[model samples]
Target: MIRLDYPIVIEPAPEEEGGGYRARVPDLPGCISDGETRQEAVSNIQQAIMAWLAEARNLGWSVPSA
Candidate 1:
């Protein structure tokens, strides 16, 4: 299993982006999560990271190393 401490960025969503907090892994393109609260957004991002890694593994993509 690939273990890495990838950087995570969480920011408040803009009005046009829908009001909520959004978390994203800067190193992983298209890996993003959003929620009503900071905690929710963070939790969702954790799941997103796992799913992203799983998909990458399934497709034989190289997992990024921190």
Candidate 2:
């Protein structure tokens, strides 16, 4: 199992973009997620972070630290 912590950037999603919230892990390029609420966005991003790490590991990519 691999565990890593990365800083997240959360911002309000644009109306045309679904009007929820967007969360992204800056340390992991292209790792992003969205949800209807801030808390939800955070939760979703946490899951996304795990998935990102898992994929990175499988692909033998370098994982960045927080």
Candidate 3:
């Protein structure tokens, strides 16, 4: 199994963007998720991180370090 620890940035979504919390892994470009609450956004981002890493591996892309 691949193991990675990356920094995440969580903030409120813009009012025009539906008002949920948004989470993203800066080291993994385009890896993002959102939820109605901070906790949920965090959980979703964890899944996003896994998916992002898996895809990178599948494509033989170098994974960035935290």
Candidate 4:
């Protein structure tokens, strides 16, 4: 069985620049998502990660070899 582990980091967007939420998966390079609400962003990123993993598996691509 192959198990993948990753860390997700979410932070609030600057209020001055219009409040929102931003999320990033540390283990996946260039994987980032933003949303107008924190919950929306988190949910979106979770799906994004799932899709990304699926694609990686389909293409036989190892995740960053980490």
**All-Cα superposition RMSD per candidate:** 1.7, 1.4, 1.2, 3.2
- Where is the poorest 10-residue window by lDDT in model 4? 1-10
**Model 3, 1-64: lDDT tens per residue?**
6565788999999989899999999899999999999999999999999999999989999989
lDDT of 2 at 58: 95
Model 2 C-alpha lDDT versus the unseen true structure: 0.88
- The model with the greatest lDDT is 3
The model with the greatest TM-score is: 3
* Poorly placed runs, candidate 3 (over 4 Å): none
Ranking by lDDT: 3, 1, 2, 4
Q: Give the count of colliding residue pairs in each prediction.
A: 0, 0, 0, 0
**Residue-by-residue lDDT tens digits, candidate 1, 2-57:** 56478989999997988889999999889999999999998898889999998998
TM-score of each: 0.86, 0.90, 0.90, 0.70
Q: Which stretches of candidate 2 lie over 4 Å from their true place?
A: 1-4
Model 2 lDDT at residue 22: 96
In model 4, the number of clashes is 0
Full-model lDDT for every candidate:
0.89, 0.88, 0.92, 0.77
Between candidates 1 and 2, name the one with more favorable lDDT. 1
User: Alpha-carbon error at 66 in model 3, in Å?
Assistant: 3.1
C-alpha lDDT of candidate 3 relative to the true structure: 0.92
Query: What is residue 25's positional error in candidate 2, in angstroms?
Result: 0.7
